[model samples]
Target: MKELINKYYQNHSLIYKVLLFLITTAVIVYFFPKGGKFKYNLQKGKPWQYENLYAPFDFSIQKSPEELNAEKEEIEKSKQLFFLVKEEVKAEVIESYNKKVDFILKDSLALKMNKARLKNFGEKFINNVYKVGFLNKADNSKIQSNQLITLRLGNEASDILSDNLFTTDELVSSIQQYFTNSSYESLENNFTSLFFEILEPNVFYDEELTNRALEEELKNRSFTKGFVAENERIISKGDMVDASKYEILDSLKKEYDTQLWSKSSYNWIVVGYTILVALVLVMLFLFLKKYRLEIFHNNTKLTFILFNIVLFVFLVTIVQKYFVGYLYVVPIIILPIVLKAFFDARLGLFTHVLTVLLLGFIVPNSFEFVFLQIIAGMVTILTVSELHRRANLFVSILKITLIYTVAYLAFSIIQNGSEQKIQWVYFGMFALNGVLSFLSLFLILIYEKSFGLVSDVSLLELSDTNSTLLRELNEKAPGTFQHSMQVANLAEASANEIGANAMLVRAGALYHDIGKMLNPMYFTENQTTSVSPHHDLSPTDSAKIIRDHVIKGIEMAKKNGLPDRLIDFIRTHHGTNTIYYFYKMQSELTPDQVNIEDFKYPGPIPFSKETAILMMCDSCEAASKSLKTPTALLIDELVEKVINTQMSQGQFMNSDITFKEIQTIKKVIKKKLHNIYHLRIEYPE
Candidate 1:
């Protein structure tokens, strides 16, 4: 049944197409009624007929002519009043004009009749006219009684016209028109009483009264009343439309159609939404498929899934918030880290490319960010690819930062094509982000530490030359220290030959026999000039005591927070191998009563290449020290014997050590052992 499901899922393209067809059919079914209605309405001149069909109520309102007539009468009254004021102002203006003319003529006549020095007479005449306020100010005194009487008789007209007072025809016309028009209106309507009552002398001085009258006139004007009446018509609801209630009903109907999946627009929206949702699922499935292979091959658990999710979310959020343009490209940094933590650099490179493509869908931008990101990510991966120590992380980050700077500058120049220097601000920001990438590695480390997930880098750090525990071992147990150093060289060489992490193997070597520090003298290698502590004890007691060191080392290691990778090497180094020499010695002394298992070093056997190498190196070193007539050939023979014995006993079975790798390890061990066991020359003294 599982196989059938798997096969069916494997042919997903056909299934997806069928699903699409079914969804299209459903959408057509749902929208058929509404689509037909829309098409019918569109054929008519009322495409918005649906809105009209749903309208619920009506109201009638209109304007009457009487109201318009009343407004017009008010407008006429204001106009009449305005004209009356205008005519009165005109008469007053004419009167002021005549007075000015009379004053000017009288002044000139005085100058001519007196025959006083005529020098500057015109200037004096103008001055005297202005001083009397004759211009627009009526001066009744300037109109002489004799001039009035002469004008009434129509006599002396020629003489008067020739005189300087009446030298111009304009002066004669001014005087005659003012007196005739002004007296005609004044006498017709008791103008003095009307002026005092309706147009007070202080009316011109009363700004407030003038403003109020102007405002009243404006209110009664035809245009203002017409505008107000039009506004009333607009405000009054008309029978043509209860548009507000109609709009509400139309909106509710639209919402109902949408809810029932009855609209064609809804179908399109659903299709688009479906496509987006399907794409998201497809992306998730692709991610799972890709990583499933890795997880299966590695025998990893959900922690890897959790870790990747964390990495994905963290990287996506960072890209979204800080570097929107580079969102797609910037997340490639996490690819190298994920690869290094979970797999290798080659896999990291592959995943980096995959991440770029995935992010391209998420973040749309110019291709330059993508190119720069790929370059930066590749540089980061390559730099950290062979890291063997914690310090290498810094070097990798620094190198990546430099590469990113150079790449950014080069790409910036290529893209911008200007003489302006690349901004250090951008470089600084990129460097800061790179540093953040470096810090993110520490987060991976902390996760690895908390979860007991051993990686090559973490193992290397634990066994580094600067490890405090290893240094302490060297100081406290020099003999064990020397032994550890020899084992480290052998293990590192063997590991390098077998395509394993040499630094991890070397570091593991330096602390593999740390258990011996607890009971150094019980072991042959640490026995200086002192008496042997195990001599008085039975072989079983001595073996038990020796076995206790492995247990003690684990406790000590735990107390110091040593990583489990190093601890594994210490635990499995002996790997159920026997104390054959002691067992043999005891078997000869008590042949029938001896139990072979009693003389064995308690172990579960080597579980990894590093531990297997440590086991071989430890045995070879101990056996090499026992050789009395040491030679390169003897050392090689003994090394091969120890390796074969371990192999025959199945000590290497659980480890990843292959037969070909074992042969390479043997050759390396033979060379190193030969150097250590080479005989010293006896010179002639």
Candidate 2:
């Protein structure tokens, strides 16, 4: 099995790559939530887009969240709280105060007051205790009516009292009034103070009993306010949907969504989702294959693009299910920004549109979601297409976020015809999304490094001559370093003319000859003295030394953390072409048995327009330096001869550069080299 897998991978064709991509897409699409599709797209105050809807079954009209909450509040407010009244409370109180009353009567005997008056005072206090009925301290304040109270005397007996019911406050008032109207008013003051201190309520609020009563009352309240009979038109066509009408339609939508699974086979839902996802993904594949074949052929690039799409869909599904109305908080625009950084604007927009469409199944308003996401994606592409600088990204993100806010506001006004109904939290979310989108810049750097991809920011950093590698190259081999700069200029100009990646070609040219730094004195470009080191060396030895630079440079670059995209230029610059000077010298010196294999540099050849342009520029710029006379004709001839020689050697055979682009590059090189070496007339001294 491993052998078969290895054999298949050895031939890595386009069909296999596409099959892998399709399998990945299928796996990713299968993980998406296929709960159910929305049956209707109705909105409040908007005309019904579908046909006149009627109740298919006699399902009860479910109440809105607001209606259900209001009903709960009403039930809570009107429900009576139950309290357990103890009828023996009065007897217990009288028993507790009997000794105190006897002490007060003994004191009256000492004062020589009337025994009848003292007895009257004790009776009045006892009557007040029974009148108030030992009100509960905790719940007596909440009793607002003089209703009947059920007194639990003991386990065996119970009594019902009709007129003794009083709240704690009323009980205290009754005690004070009884003392004030006592027959012995002056002595009753001391009695009232002492009785009030000992007063304790036997009746207590019953939490369990209250909760049981509340549960019973709530059970009677209906969650469904009314029922819609079969064949009843919920809302006719062209009707302006008011709040009440919107509630009925929404209830119908909820019911319809619930009933969708029972009416339709679940397998059909899976098939429908599969077809929709496939169609959108297939369109994306075709677009990339036709216009951006480079990315299409690369598995890493394709994986990054498709992974972003699937991840966004998964996140939207979760947010829609849990976060509900906060879907706008998701940074949908960041996907385009990140893709645009690695790929191009067209692919970014395409991926974003496909993702939003797949997520439309879960978002509440399909039209609103698609509209906002598509507009944000387009704005991201337009404002940040050329994202080479940090400030450009900041400005672009702000604009895209503002566009989301304004567009959402406009949609809100169009739907409800008023700004009062718009949720301001969504606007805050859009602004926050804009701020968070700045993280894409960092993510782009990460993707470039991880995937062996090159981005504009990395290219710009590579182009700087002051970078550690470039500065080291300049100090180690000044001549080779100058040659690299001239090649960079020529390659950049030619790339611009041919509509290729000018920045990429320029960065490649700057680092193409970094391998020479390992043994700078062996190459002619860095030879500062008149003495020639090759005079003592054999031609075969010289060729080997020259060819080893490519291998050594790759090791140094890998050690120093240079990306593979830049290392490709070092590998392909010399290609499989032979070192002609040493080979010819060796043939002339030993013509009897000349070996051609020792003179060639091992290479994969230039496979891209940027690398091929670097090869041509490297050869032309080095050859132009050998001209003895400084004239336009000599420079022009030098450029043409070098380009024609490289072309005939088939150095660009595998590259995508056309013959017409080659000619255009030749013209650009001639003009640039001429302008550099043009003669200046001698001035009179």
Candidate 3:
């Protein structure tokens, strides 16, 4: 069941693919116009409905012939009404003048009989008869009946009477006359004059009742004004070109009928979109195949890639949607970063290219932009290609900045024909982006460490010269330090021969025997005073201490933050092989209770080429010390015997070591051992 699950994840199983397909389908479906409304609306030219319906009204200047004619007719009608009313008022005024003259004369005579003065009686009688107030004025006696009745009334009353009678009558009569006696043409002329007179008081000919009659006349002609009002509201065809002016309610209805219901080009667009999505999924599947073996044990690659792809696509889509006009170049910068974090530089370059191609399809006017992106991406990939240190990552960012700057300027010049004036600005922005990339690299490193990726750069950092644990080993167990140095040299050389990571092997060698610092005297290498600590101890006790070093090394390593790879080399270098001479001597004297297997070193054996080489080197170094004459034959025999012993004991069973690699290792070790134990020349005295 576990193997099946492993294989499923390894092959990027249908479950994950289906999940991705469903998610992508959901996203595309959600954004796709429902019921073909958008397409139907588009086909029916109803794009205006999509515009904001609540937009502010735009002010504009406009004029129309109907508007002008309606306005003129309204004004003319007002004028005609004003003139007819004026005529009727004038006739009434003439009759009232004659009657008023006769009444005034009779009242004057009656006033004289009542003992009132002639002038006072005449004024009072006129005031009573006309039912009007008299104004203060000189020559009051002139108010009597005369040939023309030259009354000495105040100008207020006279003006009021003249305006109320003549102007009001003229206005009413003119309107009525326009409707009654005049031909249509004449009536139109009168109506226009009357309308102007009433509606526009300044344009009216009658000055007598201009203030009072004009307001009333305009009120009566409101129906004509309404026609002019319609003309005022009639929107011109040019005005309808505005999207807001389009009736949204009507447009929405049409869109539902035409665009939503219509099946047209949008179906093809959806088909193309789905195919693109499938292509992305396929590409992701292919890219993940490289980790098939690794993912069998760890699904980190799958998890990381899925996370980045989803995150990147979402971010790029957002940038494309909201920031429509501006170029969103973050994908160009982020693609290399994400790939470098999840995989390596080679894969990062591939991802960069893919991102550029994908984004080009999304962004408007993306040709030159995509070209710039490609240049930047390539530079970014090159910058981080062989990064084995954090400092190298930073330096790579600087290089990336320089490359991007040059590329951006060159592209800008080619595309827009812009001068070099803003090149420094571009350089500054490029440098800023490089800084961000460096920060992103740091973040990835932190995340990788958190997840225990154990990149080569981290390994190098852990193996630095000033490593505190190594320094402690040098101080506490000088003999073990010397031993580790020798082992490091031997293991590094052997690893190099076998095309393994020589530095890693060397570093692992340096820290391999650190457990000896706990009880340094028990080991022969650290016993400088000629007193062997194990001489008084039993073989079993001595073997126990010897075996304990492997276990002890692991504890000390954990305390010092040493990685698992180093600890593995420490533990497995002596792979459950017996302390042969001691165990054999004990076997001669002891019973079956003291089993030889109990004296053996506990190990799962070397699982890697480097560890296996270290194991062979450890045994070969110890055995070589016993040889008086270190010749090629002795060194060759010792190397072969140690390797063959370990191999026969099944110590190399689980390792990737082959016979060919073992032969190479033997040759290298023989040469090194021979050099170390070479015979010194006698003095020539």
The model with the greatest lDDT is 2
Q: Could you give candidate 1's per-residue lDDT for residues 1-685 as a string of tens digits?
A: 9999998988765565445434533432332232211111111111233322422222122223344567656654433111011124434633444444334334533345432232233234333322222211122223332231111111221112112232222333433443354313223222222222222110012234334666677575442111112112221122232333323333333334454465357566555544543454345345544644323223232335334543554566567667764443343475576566545555566556544544443332324455666787788766675544558777777777777778767755643355384555767667676667765566567767566566666766776666788887776777888888888888888888887767767777787777778777788777787689878988778878887788888888888887666787878888888887778878888999999998886787986677888888888887888888888878888988999999999998877678998899889899888777666799999
Q: Kindly report which residue pairs in candidate 2 clash with one another.
A: none
Tell me, what's the RMSD of every candidate? Answer: 22.2, 6.5, 20.6
Regions of candidate 1 where Cα sits further than 4 Å from its true position: 1-305, 317-323, 328-331, 338-436, 440-476, 497-499, 529-531, 589-595, 680-685
Clashes of each: 1, 0, 43
Q: Candidate 2 lDDT, tens digit per residue, 442-511?
A: 7787878677776888889889999999999999999999999999999999999987778888888898
- C-alpha TM-scores of all predictions: 0.49, 0.73, 0.47
Candidate 1 global lDDT: 0.57
Best by TM-score: 2
629, model 1: CA deviation in Å? 1.5
